[model samples]
Target: MTKENMEEGVNQKNVESTQMKEEKKIDEEDTKEAEKVNLTKVTTFEELLEVVGTRGKWNVLTFLMCILVAFTSPLQTLSYQFLGATPDHWCQVTPLLEANWTHQQILDLAIPFSNSTGRPENCYMRDYDYTAAAALGYQTTMKDPSAVLRNSSSLIQCSVREFNLSQYISTVVTEWDLVCERRVLYSTTQAVMQGGKLFGFVLFAYLVDALGRRPVVLVCSAISIIAGFLAAASPNIEFYIVLKFIIAAVDAGQYLGIFVFVMETCASKYRAGAGTLIVIPWAVGYMVVPGIAYVIRPWKLLQVAYTVPALYTIIYFWLLPESPRWLIDQGRYQEAFKVISWVAKVNRKPLPADQVVLAAMENIYHQKAQGKEADSATKTFTSRLLNLLKQLLSLLLISELRVRTIIVFFCWFSASMVYYGIALNATNLSTDPYLYIFLGGLLEVPSYLLLWPALIYIGRKKSLVALYLFCGLCIFSVMGLMLTYPGEAEVAKVFFSQIGKMAVTAAFQLAWMYTAELFPTKFRSLAVGQASFCARIGSTSSPYINDLLGPYTVWAPSALFGSVSLVSAALAVLLPETRHCDLPESNDFFTKTKEAGAEGREQGVVDQDEGVLNPSFVSEAGETGSQIHPRKSDTH
Candidate 1:
C-alpha cells in the first residue's frame, strides 16, 4: 500500500518540474529576441537617447538648467549701455559751488550754450575766473549767469570732469571720465566684449568636447562670477576692461556648454523649438536686469547682483546631469547606462536590453575613435582650412547660388546690426531706461510667437520684407522724433523703438530660418556658420555706430539702422521666395527658375529637387513634427 502512494507522489512532482522548465525556457527566448532587436537598433548615442525616451523629465530639467546659464548672458553684452553711459555732466567749477553759487549759476558762469541746439554745451566751457565770478555773486557781469555764459569767444574743452550721477551712482564713464574725447573707450570695450564672446564659443566648444559639458560650464561659470566681482572692484578702466572681456568670454562658455549638453540630450523633435525655448529664457534674464539695476542704482552693486545669479548655476554641479552621449564617448559606459536607465524610469518607459545598450555604446566608442583617427590622419588645422576654402568657393562661384548667398548674407548682417543697435540704445529711447529695456525684452517674445504664423500666412520673403520695412519705418520715425522734438516725445520715441525692436527681432528669426531654407543640405551648416560670422561683424560694429555717432547726433545710429533695414528690405524682395519650395540640393536647382506646381505646393515637393526631397508619407512625419517646433528664434 505504501509503495503505490509513493510512486503516484513522484509522478506528480516530475510533472510540476517539467512545467517550471518550459516557463523558464520561454522567458529566456523572449529576452534573446528583445536583445537581438535592440542590439542593431542604434549605432550612436543620440539615436540611443531617442530609443530611451528623449523629450521627457530629464530633457526638461536639462533645458531649464541651460536657460539658467543663459539668463545673465545679456548682462555681459548690454551692461555697458548702462554702465558706460555718460550722465548729465558739466565742467567742474568746485570753487563756485563752495561760494554758494548754484549749479545753474556755475553752468552759466563757465558753460556756454551750443549754437545749433540752444542747449548748454556739455563738453565745452568758457575760460572764466570762477573766483572772480563767485566774488561778484556770479551776477550779470557774466550776462545771465543763472542761465547762460555771457560769451562763447573763449571756449575750451572740459579740464576737470564732473558727472551728474542722478541716474547711475557710478559707471565706467563717470569713474574713468570716459566722456567727450574719451567716450570712444565705451564703444571699444563693447567691441572687445563681442570679440570675447566669439572667442569663448570657439574655446568652450573645444573644452566641452575634451572635458565634458557639465564640468566645463560649471567651472567656467565660477570663474565668470569671480571675474565679475573683480570687475566691480576694478581699479581703473584698463583693469575693468580686462575683467569684462574675461566675463564675456567665460559667460559664452557657460551658455555654450549647457546649450551643447541640452542639444545632445534633447530629442530631434524638440530641437526645432529649442531655438525659441532657448532664447526666451535669455530674454527673461535680460528683462530682469533693468529692474535689478534700477534697484541697485550703483554700477558696482548692480554688477554684484548680476554676478550672483551665475552662482545659482553652481547648483548645476549637484542637479545638472552629464550628457549620456558624452559619457559613452569617454568610454564611461556604466555611468551612461545608469543615467539612461534613470531617464527611462522617470519617463515611464522601458529601456533597451542591457547587453544591447552596452553594444551600441561600444559601437559609438569605435565610431568616435575612427573619427579621431580620421582627424589625426588629416592633421587637424590644415584640413579644416582647406575644407573651409572649398566651402567658400562652392558658395561664391556658383551662378544662382552666388547672388542668393550674397543677399542672404546681407539679410544676416542687417538683421544683426539693427537688432543690436536697437537693443544697445534701449536706455536712450526713454528717460526711464529700465522700462524701455524691460518693454523691449517683453515685446520680443511676441515676435517669436508670431514668427511661425507670419511664415505660414504671409510667405517667407514677403514676411521678411515686411519686418524689415516696419523696422526701418519705425527707426526712421524714431530719428524724426529725436530731431524734431528732442526735448519732448520721449514716450513716442520709446514706443517706436519697441515697434522697431519687435520687427527687427522677427526679421532676425526669419533670417535664421530663411537662410537654412535658402541653402541645400550640402552648404547648410557652412552657410549658417558664415552667416553667423557676418552677423558677428554687424553686431561688433553696432556699438561704435551707437557711441561714436552719439557726439555728432543722437539720431545718427537710428538713421544708419533705418537706412540699412530699408535697403535690406529691398534686397529681400530680389530673393526668390522659399516658402513651400524644395530645399535646392545643387546650384543647378537654383538655375531652374520655374516655380513648383500646384500639387507640390499643396502636398509638398519631390520633382523640384528629384531624389532627396521626397513627398512620401513616411518623410512627412519627420518634416511635419519638426515644423511644429521650428527654429523661431535663437539668442546670439
Candidate 2:
C-alpha cells in the first residue's frame, strides 16, 4: 500500500458516498411529489354533488332562502320608485302661485297652510309667476278691463273706491298659493323622505349584522307593508311623507339583510356570482319604478303597487331557512349539521355521517383555537364594537382591500348620480317621463347577466376597470353632447345619457362582487358595510350636488365622479389579482410582499428580513454555502 494508492482509494469512497446520497434525495423528492398529488385528488365535484344530494331537501330550501334574500334589493328599490312620483308632480305646480311674496311672508303663510291642509311647508310656491304677471308682462297695479269683466263688472266698479276688492283678491291669491299648492307640500315631504333613507342606511347595516338576517328582513317586510298602506291612505302631504320615510328606512333593512344572507349561504366557489346576482334585483326594481308610477297615476295608488311586493316578502319568511353559514359562524354546530344534512338529503345521496361530524368538530376546534366562543357574552357590545373597528381599519389599510373599496365607492357614487339624475330629469325629456325611466332601467338586465361571466373569465381587475372606464366615458360623452348641441339634439342627448346610466348601473353591480372577493370571510360583512357606508355618503351628496350644479350642468358631478372612478381604476392596478387567489388570512402587506418573491429563486432579496436571500446576484467574493441554500439563508 503506497501513498498514491491510499489517496486514490479515499477519493473513490468519497465519490460513491456522494452518488448514493444524491439517489436517496431524488427518491425522497419523488415520494413527496406523489403525496402532494394524492392530497390534491381527494376532493372532487362528484363527491360534493353526492354529499349535496344526500341533503337534497335542505339544499333546495337553502337555495330558495338565498333567492328570497336576494329579492329584497328589487323589492325595496321598486317600492321607493312607486312612491317616488308624489314629489315629482307636486314640484311642477308650486312656482306658478307664489309670484310676489317675500321669504318671511311665504314662510308665515306656509306654516298655517301646512297645518290646516296637512301638506309640507316647503312645498309653497317660490316668488315667481310664469303665466300671468311675469310671462304676459302685466304689472300688479294695472287692472285690465277683461280682468274686471271676469271678476264682475258691478263689484269691479264698486271696488275701485269703496270695497277695496283688489286687496281682498290679493289675500285670496296668496292664500291659494300657500294652501292649495301641491309643489309646496311635496318639497317638504321629499326632504323628510330623503332623511329617512339616510337614517336607514346607517342603522340597517348594524341591525342586520347583529340580529341575524332572517328576523330582521321579516321585520323589514312587515314594516314596509304597513308603511305602504299608510302612505296609500294618507289624505295629505305630511302623512304621505312621514309614511314614505318609514317605508324607505325599512326598505334599507331589506337591502342590507338580504345581500348578507344570500352571500353567506353560497359556496366559496360561487360566492362572487351569488353576490353579483343580488344587484340584479336593484336594476329590476329601478325598471319597475317608472312603469308602476305610470300605471298607478296618483301617488296614493302607487303606494298600493309598492305594498304588493311587501306582501310577497312577508310570505317568503315562511319559505326560507336561516343561513347555515351564519349559524356555523355563530357556533351553532347542531344547526349547521342539520342544515347540511338536509342539503345532502335533497341531492338524493347519503352523506358520510362520520365525515360530517369530523368537519363540524374541526370547525368548532378552529373557532375555539381562535378564542371565539358560542356564548353571546363573547360577542359582547364592547367586543363586537372593537372587532368592527378593527375590521374597518384593516379594510382601509390593506392595499387590495382599499383599492376595491375606493372603486366600489366611486362606482356607486357615479351610478347613483346618473340613475337619480335621469329619474329626476325624466320630466324634462318627454311627456311620458316614467316610460323613459323604465326603459333606462330595463337596459341594466342584460348588463347584469353579462357581468358575472366577464368577472369569472376576464378576472376582477380588468372587468371592474373596464366597466368603470366605459361608464365614465359614456357620462363624459353625454356631457359633451349636452353642452355642444343643447336643444338641437335634445332627444339624442337624452338617449345617450340613458345609455350612460345603464353602463354605470352594470358597473355598480360588478363592483359589489369585486369588493366581496377582495376581503376574507371573517370580515366579509364588515368590509361590505364600510364600503356601502362610503357609497351612501356619495348617494347622500348627489341631490345637493345636482341642486348646486343643476341637472343640465351635468359636468360637475359627472366630471367629479368620472375623475374619482379614473383615479380608482389607476389605483386598481396596484392591487394583486384576486380572481384565482385564495382570500388572505391577514392583511399583512409584508407577508404578501414576501410571497411575491417566492416564485423565482433568481430574484434579489425583497426586504431586510431573516431567512431571505438574494441567490442570483451576490458579492464578488468567494461564494458562501449559505447563499446557495435560499431556504436556509438569512439576509438580515
Candidate 3:
C-alpha cells in the first residue's frame, strides 16, 4: 500500500466523523426546544383545581341544577314506547256496526282466527258480516254471533280497519292505521329516531368541540322543546317522522352538554358516584313515563305530558357556565379566570392569582397544540380513513393491545344489543306494556345501585363477567321456561326477563368507563367513539331481532342476545387486569417516539407519533375490574 492512498482513506473517515457530530448537535437543539414548550406545561388544570376546590358549594349547586335538567333526555326518549305503540286492531265491519250488532258480536262474526297466533287475525277475517243476522234479531247479548255466521265463508281483505281503544285513547298505530302488514312503519319510527340519535351524537360532539358547549346545548334544548311540542301537532306521519327525528337528534345535546358539564364541574374523585347519582334521576324519569302515558291515554296528550318537564331547562341559559378547560382553549383567559374565581369565592376557598390561572391555561394550550399538530398531519377524508384503518390494524395486529380491543368491542356490541333489545321488548313482555316498562325502570334502580359498589369492590372484569353470566342465565331461563312450561310460568318468564334487563343495563353502563380504561390517551376518544358504531348496529337491529324473529319462535331474540352476553364474558378472560395498571401511554407503544421524554417516562407509557389511542387512552377511568396478570411496570 502507498502512503498517499492510506492518507486519503484516513481523511475520508475524519470528514464522516465531523458530519456526524454536527448533525448530532442540530438534533439536540430541536429536542431542547420541544422540551421547553412541553415540559413547561406541567401546571395542569388539576393543579389549578386543587386551589379552587372541586366539590365546593359552587360544584354542588351546579350538580343539583344539572340533575334537575337531566330529565329531558330520558323522558323524551322512553315515552315513545306508548306514543308510537301499535294498538289491537281488526277489520272495520261497518255493515254490522251500523245494523246494530254489538262491537263484540261484530268482531266474532267478522274476524277469523289466525292459525299462527291462535287468536283472531288482525289483518284477515271472514268476508261475511252479521248485518243480516242482526236484522233478523237472532243474535244478541244472550246469543253467540259465531253460530249465525256460516263457517264456510271465504276470507277477504278488509278495506277499513278498527282499533280497540280501551287501553289507549289513541296511538300512532290507530291514527295511522299502521296495523297488520303496515306495522313495519311503527318499527321504522323507532329506527328513524335511533338513526337520528346516532347521527346527532357524532355531529353534535363535533359542533360542541368547535362552538363551545353552552351555545350548542342551549340550541339543542330549545330545538328539543319545540320539536316535542310540534310532534303533538304533526299533521301526518311524514310530519311526525321529521319532528321526532329532530327531537331524537337534538337529544344528544342534552347528553353531551348537561351531563358533560356536570361531570367536568364535579371533583374527579367523585366521578363514579356522580355518574351513579345522575342515572338515579334518569331511571326515575323512565319509571314515571309509563304512569304519565297510562293517565294521558291519548298519544298527543302523552307527548305534551312527557315534554312539559324539559321546559324547566329554560333556566339553564342563565345558570349554566362554560367549561373552564374550553374557556382556556378558546383563549378567553380573563373569562376563565373570572369563572374559577367565582367558584373559589362561592366555595370559600382562596382565590387564585391571575398569574397562576394564566400559567396553567398556557400549559394546557401548549399541550393541546402538540395534539393538534399530530392530528393536522392527516386532514383529508381519505387520510383520516387510512389513519383510522391503520390504528384499527395496530390494535388487532399488535400483541399486547389486540386482546383488549377485541374484548372491548364485543363488550360494547353485546351490551348495546341486549340492553336496548330488552328495553324495547317491554310491550311484548306482558299483556300490560306499562307494567313491563315500570318494572324495567324499577329494576334499573337496584342494578345501578349495585354498580358503584360492584365496581369498587369486585373490580371491572369480575363484575362484568358475573353480571353478564347471570344475565345470560336469566335469559336462557326465560327461553326454556317459555318453551317448556308456557302458561303456568308466565310470571316467572317476565321475572327472569326483567332481571336480565337489570344485569345488562349495569353492564352497559360499566362498558363506557371500562372501554376508556383499556386504551391509552392518544386514541382513547377515537376508540370509545368507534365502538359506538358497533353499539349502533346492535341497538338498531334489536327491535328487528325481536319483531322479525318472533313469529318463528318466542325465544329466538333471547337466544341470540343470551349467547352474545356469554361470548362477551368468555372473551373477557383474555383481557389484562387494568385495575391496578395505568392506561396505555401511547396508541402504538411499539413505535417509540424520539420526542418522548420525562412525561412519557413518568407515566410508564411509551411515546408514539399518533393522535387517537392505538387502542384509545382513558384520561380518568371511574372504576376497574379484574385482569389476569398485572405488573407494576405495565403502563396500559
Candidate 4:
C-alpha cells in the first residue's frame, strides 16, 4: 500500500476505536445510575414497611407516657374547683354571728381558751371575727341586724344554717374558716403548679435537647411519685401547696419529655397523629377528675386521688426505651443501634446488622458535612449568653418555627379559655358536672381519630381551619344561647355550652398535631416548649378573666378565643401545606427556599429582593417517608 493511504487508514481506525470506548463508558454510567435508583427504591419500601410494622410498640409506649403526662391537665382543673369551694366554709359562718352573739363573745368561744396546760392565762385571743366573716369579703364589727343582713354577710348565715351549728363551737371556726384555709391552700397549690409548668418547660426543653428525652422523663416520673405522695399526705395547707408545686414541676418535665420522646421515635407520617393521640389521655384525665372529686369529697383526699397516677412511673423503668432518633442526633450510633434492634426484636423482625451500621455511618457523615456548612455560613457567638440569644433569634425568626409558635399560642390560649370556661361553668350549666365533663372529654376522641385521616388526606391547613371555625361557631352559638334566653331555657343553655366544650376540646387536640408538624427536627423541643409556654399564659389568664366576668362572662373569653382562632385560620393560609411532605434535610431546605423566592420575584408581584423566602427560616420536614418535589422557582 502507499504511505498516505496507510496513514489515512490508521487515523480512521483510531477514530472508530475512540468512539467505541466512549460508548462503553456511557453504558457503564447508565448501569450504575440504574442500580442506584433501584437501591433507593428498595430502601424506601423497606423503611415504609418497617415504620408501619413498628406502630404497635410505638402505640403502647405512647399511650403509657401519655397517661403519665395527662395528670397535670386535670390537676389544674381540680385545683380551680378546690379554690372555688373555699367560700363554702365562710358561707357557713354567717348565721352564727347573726344569732344574737356579739363578735367578742363569738371570738372568745371560737378561740381555744385553754393551752395544753388547760390554763386560761396561757391562751392567746384570736384577732379576726370568726363568726362574722363572709365567704370572701372584708369583715365588719357592726352588729346592726340590717348590716348583718346584707346579702354578702348572709353567706355566713347560709353556711351556719346548712351546717346547723351553734354560736359556741360553731361551724364558723371549724368549717367556715377551715374552708377559707383550704382555699388558701389550693390557691397556693395552683401557684406552685404554675411555677412548675414554667420551670418544667424551660428545664425539660433544654434537657431533652442536651441529655435526651428518656432520661428526663424517667427522672420526672421519679420526682412525680415522691411529690405526689407528699402532696397526698400533706398535714396542712402550707405543706400541700409546697409539695403540689414540686409535683407539678416534675409533672411538667414528664409532660414535655413524653411529647419529645414520642414524636422523635415515630415515623414522620405517623408523627402528627401520635402527637395528637397523646392528648387523649389528658382528656381522659379531665373526665376522671370530676368522678375522683366526687369520691374524695375533701380537697386533701382529692389531692391524693390525683397523686396516685405517679405510681405508674415504676412501670416506665422497665418498659421505656430511649428514642432512636434522639440517639442518632447525639451521634450515639451504638446506642441508636441497640434501641432500633430492640424495636425490631419486639416487632419480630430482624434488621441486618450491617444495614444498621451503614445507616448510622451515613447519618453521621451527612450530619457532620451539614454542620460544617452551617458553621461556615453562620456567625460565631462571642459568649454563652450571646450564643443563646442567637439560638433564640434563629428559632423565632424561622418562618416555620415562628408560625408554629404563634399558631400554637393562639390555639392554646383559645383552648384554655374555652376548656376552662366550660368546665368552671359546668355547675351553672347543669347539676351533673361529672357527666358534663365526661361528655366533653369523650368528644375529643373523635377529634384525634379525625386528625389521622385529615392530616393524611386533606392536609394540615384545611384540618386546622375546619377545627378553628367549628370551635368559633360553637362559641358564638353558646353566646347566643346565654344572651337570647338568659333565665328561660336553663336546660338548653347548659346543653349548648356542653356542645361548645366538645367542639373546643376537639380543636385543642388537633392543635397539638398542627404544632408538631410546623417545627424542624433540630428545634422541635424548643418549638413545642414555646408553644406550650404561650398556652400556659392563656391557661393562667383564663381564671382571672372568668372571675372578673362571672359564669355568664364565658362569652368574653369565647369571643377572644374565637378572634384568635380566626387569626390562626388566616395564618394557616400563609403556610405551605405539609401533608405528605417529607421532612426536608437541613441542606435541601435552604436550597428550596432560594429557588422558591427567585420564582416569586420573577412573577413581578412585588419586590423580589424584599420578599425572598429563606429556606433556613422555614422548618423542613426531614427524611420523612414521603416524596418531596424539588423547588420549581423562588415564587413558591
Best by lDDT: 1
RMSD of 4: 15.9
Would you list the C-alpha lDDT of every candidate in the order shown? 0.70, 0.52, 0.68, 0.55
Model 3 agreement with the true structure over 163-198: per-residue lDDT tens digits: 888756789878888766777777767766766676
Worst 10 residues of 1 by lDDT: 608-617
TM-score for each of the candidates? 0.74, 0.66, 0.78, 0.71
Model 1 agreement with the true structure over 1-636: per-residue lDDT tens digits: 699999999999999999999989977775565555565735445467766676777667767767666677876677776677668888887778789887787775677777865667878888766666777776654765434444446677876777777766888788888877787787877877876765675556556666777887788878888998888898898888888878877876776667656655765344445645666766787788677777776778777887877778778878777778678867899988888878877775555578767888888666445413233345689898786465456678766578878988888888888898888785455466677778878887888777766665556777888999999999999999999998689889888988998999988867766675676534554565566556667887888887677556788899999999999999988776554443333333343332323334433332222211212112234553112212224111
Give the higher-TM-score candidate: 2 or 3.
3
lDDT of 1: 0.70
Cα displacement (Å) at residue 222, model 4: 1.0
Q: Which parts of model 4 have CA positions greater than 4 angstroms off?
A: 1-53, 56-79, 82-195, 235-239, 354-361, 364-382, 427-431, 551-555, 584-591, 594-636
lDDT, ranked from best to worst: 1, 3, 4, 2
Residue range with the least summed lDDT across 10 consecutive positions in model 2: 154-163
Regions more than 4 Å wrong, model 3: 1-42, 85-87, 114-118, 129-154, 329-332, 367-409, 515-530, 573-636
Model 2 misplaced regions, further than 4 Å: 1-50, 53-198, 234-239, 354-361, 364-394, 397-408, 428-431, 551-561, 581-636
Output the TM-score of candidate 1. Answer: 0.74
- CA shift of 78, model 1, Å: 2.3
